[model samples]
Target chain A: MEKNRNRVIIASIVIGIVLVVNILPFLWLVLTSLKTRLDIFAIPPKFIFDPTLKNYVSAFTKRDFLPMFYNSLIIAVSSTLLSLVVGTLGAYSLARFKIFGDKHISFWILSTRMFPPIVLVIPFFIMATQMGLHDSRFLMVIVYTTFNLPFVVWIMRSFFEDLPFDLEKAAMVDGYSRWDAFWKVALPLSAPGLFTTAILCFIFSWNEFLFANVLTAANAKTVPVGIRGLVTSRAIEWGEIAAVGTLQVLPVLIFTFAAQRYIIRGLTLGAVKG
Target chain B: MARVILQNAWKKYGKVEAVKGINLEIKDGEFVSLLGPSGCGKTSTLRMIAGLEAITSGEIYFDDQLVNNLDPGERNIAMAFESYALYPPMTVYENIAFPLHAAKLPETEIKERVGRIAEILELTDVLNKYPRGLSGGHQQRISLARALVRDADVYLLDEPISHLDTKMRNRMRAELKRIHSELQKTMIYVTHDQIEALAMADRIVVMNFGVIQQIGSPQEIYFQPQNLFTADFVGEPPMNFIDCRVKIGQGTLLISFDDSVFKLQNKEKVEKVANFENHEAQDFVLGVRPFYFGISKSITDSERETNFLRGEIFAVEPLGDSKIVHVKSGKNHLLVEADSRFMGQPDETIFLIPDAGHLHLFHKKTEEALF
Candidate 1:
């Protein structure tokens, strides 16, 4: 009984420490976002500062954040959907049929994602300018797809591989053609995995600053670039930065929490045994 | 309603041959089992017949129509996979009704067929539930019901009961036999388990290393095997082998082995052996199943048993109604399954006599069956 009690006490202490570590930053983000500039620098950073919505008001209205939000949404949505269309077929083909040059091909695709994104920016800029797609949301879709397609193909391939080829064949034997079997049986069953991949792909595209800054200017500025625009030359708007940070991080947090189950499954799949 | 014929069918997975030129004829309303060990191309053969895998060469005919170029859907064959292939998103009713709906059957008829088959598979309670909500057995039966519900030309089942527990496998085996009798549909099943093949199949095609060893009814494969591999691979404990040589004495032919000689009967067989009169066989493998050997009271009870061997009991396994005794005889060991009433103590001397009818002779070099 005493041993069991000791174990419980130890567990509770560890759990308490974890909870504080995980929640402390968000609490600080909220607390600092609400404080005035004077209260923010009140000697030792006061815990009880009077809250105000001035930072949020300035962060939203004056900053042209709405258009930036729309840019991020458009690029992220289109990129995610586009990757799903092509990546799903590629993934299923790799999983089921023995395509020619499959292993080298999959490895080559994965290597592109592993390459430093900064190294590709120069060439990408040149190509985007030549095609007259520079500073356009359309080019961002292509950029997002470049990174997301590898992971998307790999993730969907694993999810499909874990599923036996028998189901699809059984469907075919039940009078469904190959394409019909994929759409009717294989694709629908892998929705949770697809949704998980979509959220991650969207998150990557939304939080991307390097490609966004290099590729966009006035019209197609994403949230991250918009947040960077808050950092002026001399007087830095720390309050606006905090508010923008909250906005940038909010959707991702909600997305992660909403589909946390699938996210964990996807992460484990990509990390191990994949 | 269907007849599946494979003409010199071969499957090559990049030089490693999976199915090597197998010719099979599965009649309408017959249950044929393709039996072998793992990686023996049994599944490859079944997939080829189902139009799932392409035949590297040769042709497959269904009811006198060439189906080599046809897709699986165009073949009109129903197949259940080893993995229970239930669409996880759909309800059990919907999964079962999928084939019927694809064939453009009426909704009412689809519901009726799905309901009846579900009841038969004991899946009626899970009709509204998705496949993920059911147990492995329930999901497997649902898959089976889906395959059986469609009135296709042929049914191809690949180790349908391999996932079930032992008791369920036996129960399902009985159910399958009953269903086959009632439905009278052409079915081809694949399994590596010898017991499953022997118990459930009307005819069996035995294969090894991508070659057809033999094709025969259960009795023909069991009692009269075509080769040494079939004799060894078919039985439960499997047939035992002993080295022997043929010698003809004055007016009698005898085979000698392990310091004992057995008089060979059948003058015609002896005459065939006499053909090798000058050219003597260095050795021959004597094949005998455990059931062919019987235990006597003692080594002294040898009466008319001329071809007798003695061994000390090593292990005694109680098989409920019978005791399988492992005895270490001279130069070799032998298994003797005795009556359950007589459980011989270990290390006791046991004399064994092979039943004349069940004894087998084989060529030592080629492993071919000899008379």
Candidate 2:
């Protein structure tokens, strides 16, 4: 019992260290955003300074933060939804049928993710510019889909494979058509996997920087790109930057907590059965 | 209410042939069992009949109508998988009701049907519970109930109770037999268990290595097996075979095995042994069940019993109802089912009398029973 108690103490201390390491940056961001300009640059990094909402006011009023946040939301939601629809069908096909060259096709879809995003930014830039879609939110949604499709397919295919084929066969034997079996039986059982894949896809699309920076200019600039705009040549608005960073993290934090159960299941790739 | 027939049906998965040209005729309302060891194409045959698998050649007829091109739904067949493939997301009530709903039955009729089957299976209390929370036997009964809810032409059960505990399996076997009699539906059961096949089937189609070995009533398969596989596969503590040499003597044929000679008095038994003489080899195999072999404490009446084999008891297995005394004579071993009260020590000399009336003869090379 003493040994177990010591082990628990050691484990708790380790966990405390990890929690501090992860949460410290966000805490600092929040604290810095609330500091006045005089307190932000104080020599001792004032721990007991008076907090202010001046930075939030400047970020919203002077920098157009709300529009950029909206832009990020629309792109993330649209791309995640689109990828899920197309990817689920592709996954079901890969799981159920004996299509010719299916293995190669699945590998090919996954290989699209192997190339660094920076390499494709130029081609995408050229195409977007040529098509007059350079500053369009629709264009960003399309680009985000290209990145999320393979991930959704791979994850959902595993979920479908984890389901017993007999369920669908039994459904068919019980007077259902093939499509009905998929819609009613296979789809509902994969609810956990679907939620997990959707969250991951949304997170990736929400936090993406390289393409969002290169593709969007003024009208379609996402929050990540907008945060970089705060870094002007003359002077950096440290308070506003800190405020925007904290604000940018709010949705993701809320999303993680809201669907924490499914996120764990998704991260383990459905290896934890049910 | 359909008569199912398979004519020269075959299934091929790439280069591997799973079912090699099986032909069968199942009468209306008959409970036929497809019995075999694993990889014996029994499941393949059942799947083909259900239209879950495509036949590579020949035709399947349901009531004289060719159903080779039909899907499982179009063929009007219901199957209960061994895995108890209950829809995990649905309640027991919805899982059973899914088929009737798919067939677009009226709401009142669907409710009535699901309720009746659920009550019969004793799943009424847990009607709202998901299958994953149910016990294995309950899940199996729910699967059966789901299949039974529909008025399909035939019901195909693929080892539905093979995974249950021994006691539950026996109880479920009895329930299945009772259900078959009450419903009077055409059911095709696939299982590797011999006892299940013998207990429930009206007729059994025994298969091995992707071919149907024999189709016969349980009695025929038990007592009059047409082939060696059927004789060996059906019985518990299976039939013992002894190699014997044939000797033609004074208008009677004497079969000799390990210093034991038995005269074939019956004309049928004599003709079966005599027919083996047409082949060059005179060696033949004689098969006898353990129940037919008698065991005695000593050989006091040796002169009266000519069919007695001399051996020492190798081992004794005391079953609750009876005992199996294993006797070893020279190179051969025989199992004798004696009364439970009968006691014998290991290595004690025991006299075994092979009842000539129950002996079966087969050609040594062909393995085909002569009678």
Candidate 3:
């Protein structure tokens, strides 16, 4: 009993340290976003100052951040949906059928994501320019979808593989076609995995900067690029940056917390035998 | 409702031949069991019949209609998977009702069927519960209910009760047999348990490796196995195989094991040995079930003139109804069933005489039954 208590104390301490370390920067950003310009630059960092919404007001009004937020939402959601639809079908096929060169095909799909984004950014820019699709939200969606597809396919494939093929077989024997078996039985059973994969795809497309930075500008500028624009040549608009950063992190936080239950279950889905 | 037939059906996975060319026919309303150990292609054959697996070659028919290219849905079959395979998200009721819904049945009819099956399987109380939290037996019953609730032409069950505890397994075996009789639908059951196959099936198709070893009624499979695999696989405590040489002397057939010789008194058996080629002395395997052997504590001088062979007891296991005595005669170790009250000690000399009418002779090399 005594040893277990001591072990519990040590574990709690480690967990507390990790929580503080991870949350500290985000907490500071939220605090700074609510502070006056002078309070943000205060010595020793003002932890308990009277907060103001002036930074948020300016970031939304003078900088036209709302439209950029809309653009980010559109691109992130569209790209995530597109990736999931195509990748899930591909994953189901790869999981169930004995396709020739399956191992090579899966590895090749994953290899696309291994290439550093910088390596392909220039080529993508040139292609977008040549096709007269530069700086459009459509182009940004396509780019994000291409990058996110491989991750979706790889993760969903394992989820599909973990499901007993017997479930689909049972469904088929119960008078369902192969397609119905996949859609009705396999897909519903994999809800936790789908929820987890969607959240990851959304976050990846939402927070992505390098490709969004190079591929989009002006009308299609996402929140990340819009925040980068606030770092002017003369002086860094720290208050506005912090305000937009808090706003940017808010949706992802809400999305993750809303799906937190499924995410936890999904991560540990196949750990136990049925 | 359908007579199922397999015409030289085969299944191959890449380079591995899972099911060799096999021909079988199941009459309408017949309950046939495919019995074998793991990797023996019983499950594969069931899947092929269900149309869940495409045959690598040859054909399958349902009621004389070719179903080789049909999807499982089109084949109009229902199957309970060995893995249970209950949909995790659905309640037991929905899982059972899923096939009916797929068939586009009326809501009232679907509810009626699901409720009936759930009640029959003793799952009514858990019908609202999801499959994930249920006991294994409950989940298994739900899988069975799902298959039986459907109005398919044939019902296939793959090791449905194999995972249940012994008591539940026995109960479910009787329950399944009762259901088969009530519904009178053609049922194909796959299992590795010989007891289940023997108790439940009208006909048992015993398989080994990827080929059919024998297909016969339980009595036939137990008493008159056509080959070594069937004989060895079917019986509990198994048949004891004694290596013996059949020597024809005068008008009698002398079956000798080591230095001990037993006279074959049955004229029909003597004729079988005589007709099994014209060799003077031929090696044959003598198979005797443990129950068929009569053991005596002391052999009379007159009994030695009969077919009694002598052996020393290796061990004795006293079951309630009978005692299994392990006897060592020279190099052979044989089990003989004796009366439970008969107290026999290890290393005690005993005389065992097999029933002459129940003897099985198999050719040594070919392993085929001689009678």
TM-score of each: 0.90, 0.95, 0.97
Question: Per-residue CA lDDT of candidate 3, range A1-274, in tens?
Answer: 9999999999999999999999999999999999998998899888999989999999988999999999999999999999999999999999999999999999999999897789999999999999999999999999999988998899889989988888888888877888999999888777778888899999998999998899887989999988989889998999999999999999999988998888765433452246
Cα distance off (Å), candidate 3, residue A113: 1.4
Off by over 4 Å in 2: A266-274, B280-282, B299-305
Name the lDDT value of residue B212 in candidate 3.
94
Tens-place lDDT per residue, model 3, B254-328, is 888888887876787788788888545566888999989989888788777878778999999988898889999
Per prediction, fnat is 0.71, 0.77, 0.80
Give a tens-digit lDDT track for model 1, residues B1-371: 79999999999989899999999899999999999888889999999988889999989999899999999999888988777777766788998999998899998999899988887778889899877757778777888988999998898898888877899889999998988899999999999888888998999999999889999998888987878888888998888888888777764568788887777676765776676535255577788899889787565545455667778898999999888889888888888878898767888887888887787777777777766
Backbone clash count, each prediction separately: 0, 0, 0
Question: For model 2 chain B, where is the 10-residue window of minimal lDDT?
Answer: B272-281
Which clashing pairs does model 1 show? Answer: none
User: Which portions of model 1 show Cα errors greater than 4 Å?
Assistant: A1-25, A266-274, B128-136, B248-253, B271-279, B298-307, B310-315, B347-350
TM-score of chain B of each: 0.94, 0.96, 0.96
Quick one: best lDDT, which candidate? 3
What DockQ was computed for model 2?
A: 0.55
lDDT of 1 at A80: 89
Docking class of 1: acceptable
Arranged by lDDT with the best first, the candidates are 3, 2, 1
In terms of TM-score, how similar is model 1 to the real structure?
0.90
lDDT of 1 by residue, A231-252 (tens): 7998778787777778878888
DockQ of each: 0.44, 0.55, 0.67
